[model samples]
Target: MRRHILPPVTRPILLLFALAALAGCGPTAEPAKAAADEHGAAVDEFERGPHRGRLLRSGDFSVEVSIFEEGVPPEFHVYAYRKDKPVNPRELTLTMELTRLDGRVDRFSFAPQGEFLRGAGEVREPHSFDVKVRALEGGRAHQWAYAAYEGRTTITSEAARAGGVTVETAGSIVMAELVDMAGRIEITPEGQADVRAWYPGRVMALNAELGQTVRKGQVLARVESSHSLQTYSIPAPLSGVVIAKNSNVGDVAGGEALFVIADPTKLHAEFFVYPRDAERVRAGQRVEVRTLSGDNRVVAPVEAIVPTADIASQTLMAHVHLPPGASATFRPGMGVEGSFQVAAWPTALAVRTKALQRFRDFTVVFARVGNTYEVRMLELGRQTPEWTEVLGGLEPGTQYVTDGAFLIRADIEKSGASHDH
Candidate 1:
């Protein structure tokens, strides 16, 4: 159903337009012919009533079809006249049907309202459809059929693919408030271990070397006690890769660590928060962490916020834990980027942000039904890079063009189609 007020929008016009904007864009259908009458003759007359509505005639019975959409959803107002004389709305029975591209039919029956007949249902958007009207008056039957289109274009399957046209369904989404910050990957102090000999002595044999992976309690080195002249085995304190080795074979191990082991998997990303974002950023908020090259990404909550500012940059820091399995790709000291979710809002109706485009004075998206794509004007609310809240002008479950929408708009403009009564 119609959601907001719009101007005269439905007009049957050119269908076939150039796909010249892209290379190898396949064949398109030919331009459509004019709307035909009940006798199958091309209707070529252009008649407008005093209300600026379309005028159709069958003998002495004529009806003016107009849409009233000032401050409400679109509704049809039919003014009946017999030989230029106003006919009481009660004297006629009128019904209209609109067949849309997707094979859905909308029927509206007219009832007496003031001096004219008002439709029982709303006239929805895009307004591109085949219209049929039947009127009964004074024991006579009158029929008129025509095509009305606005913001519509047709394309074949191959053309759509070659033009990079993509479609996605519109639905509910949660809008996030993001704060971008520069960051780096690091290993926490708990991830590192220092191995030391129990007694001051000369290292007789070194079992573990730098850059070697070792298990907890694994023999790291053997040392001889200088005090008692007894030999002892030095073991690794934690299971990790040996990052540092000080005392080696034949070297004196006197009050010094011999090996340093660090768990590469225990990592966190530190993001620098500026003064402006200090109030909004806090621990426990969700953060989107990505590598410098943007090839890898992960979502995790902020592990904690450093209470003190960096001595060099004077910026606050937010730490987000990296997945344990991510150590193979993300490493210590590697530069990264993190987007902190400072706030969020949930919405029931939303569309892809990438699908939105400018149409006239409105922001619109191309809605798809079979091979036809038409513009859907939107009233917007909160917006993010991913989705935007749809305040009006769209229905749930509608498929919309998310990519190559520019191609559709270009064709409609090149074919000279516009909002027309």
Candidate 2:
């Protein structure tokens, strides 16, 4: 070989150009190196095909697999190319096998559709799977397998604990089916009394104030009898709290009520049962009474169901007797709510309401298997305020995520490892 010498200035320029060409080749060689992996099974995480899908390569052939979910169920779309040239999709048959993180294996076959192939059936969601593709061309089989996961991630036990994630085991529970109704606290008729003027008189002095406790025959006021003009004492008719005081000092008293008293400890909850649930409201049934704010709850048995229904509301009245100590938290005329238990059943599998989540089209619970949380679908039955009866889809003693499941879901979505597969 003959050596030709160039000027020093030209030599530097040629060297710079050579270096630039090599740097350009660096990027293009990356995809070639990835394609040269064992069986051409390499996943370019940052690269996607024109259809925004995973690109799998085997020898001279490349296939782009995408999920098209526009106005239809999710199905696979596969586009084929041979050595950077668009290959006729009709000359090839493609099939795919997906093994999910939960150990579920799904096989899909593609059929020729216009310029590409479409997979049969709808692809499931949370698209995390190990993918394998086989393409039959000219009586020869070319295959590639790679792990392609979207919207899936694993968190360590320490991280989970730091994030407040908690778990509980699924088990059996006794659930009560209840009929909810509106109610109010009322003083029973026998528990209330009205203080009246024994004789026509003039009130001379008033002692009892509104809401004051008075004993039976306690002097509430002194009055002067109009007949004899003699000042006499007026007394409370019962030992109860004074709810109303209508008389004032030095006022003339007639046959009208001077004071209203009620025994707060002898109160009852009166619930109105709508026509739809009136038949289920029966005496002796178990009832749970709660304030509208849900701060207080009292379990009492139904004392009676009134025979007549309210004409305007068409609701039957059910009364529950309150214990004497109920006066501490409840008062007459206070609005309340009550639930009457009409049926009860034993469930073999149950979980807390917080453990349930809506993912895709299924109600799912996250089951902790080792360090991995697997999504478990649920078939639910009757539900209560705290527990939900599980009819199927969960086994007893299975530990599931309860408190911080949404956080795990957020992590999975952030990882972009789950999608409709």
Q: Relative to the true structure, how large is the alpha-carbon lDDT of every model?
A: 0.79, 0.74
lDDT tens digits by residue: candidate 1, 1-421: 1122222222233452111111111122112336654433333334667787766667667788888888987899999988868899999999999887667899999999998999998888766677777888887777777666767777775667767788998888788889889999999778888888899998999998789999988998999999999999988877899999988699989877898899999999989888889999988999999897788988888989888987887889888987898898889999998889999988989988878998877799998887778889899999887779999988888999987777778766655445554
lDDT of 1: 0.79
Q: What are the candidates' C-alpha RMSDs?
A: 9.0, 15.6
**Over all chains combined, what TM-score does candidate 2 have?**
0.57
Model 1: colliding residue pairs: none
Looking at model 1, residue 168 earns an lDDT score of 90
- Model 2: residue 101 alpha-carbon error in angstroms: 12
Name the top TM-score candidate.
Answer: 1
Model 1 alpha-carbon drift over 4 Å, by segment: 1-52, 68-93, 102-122, 254-256
Q: Output candidate 2 Cα RMSD.
A: 15.6
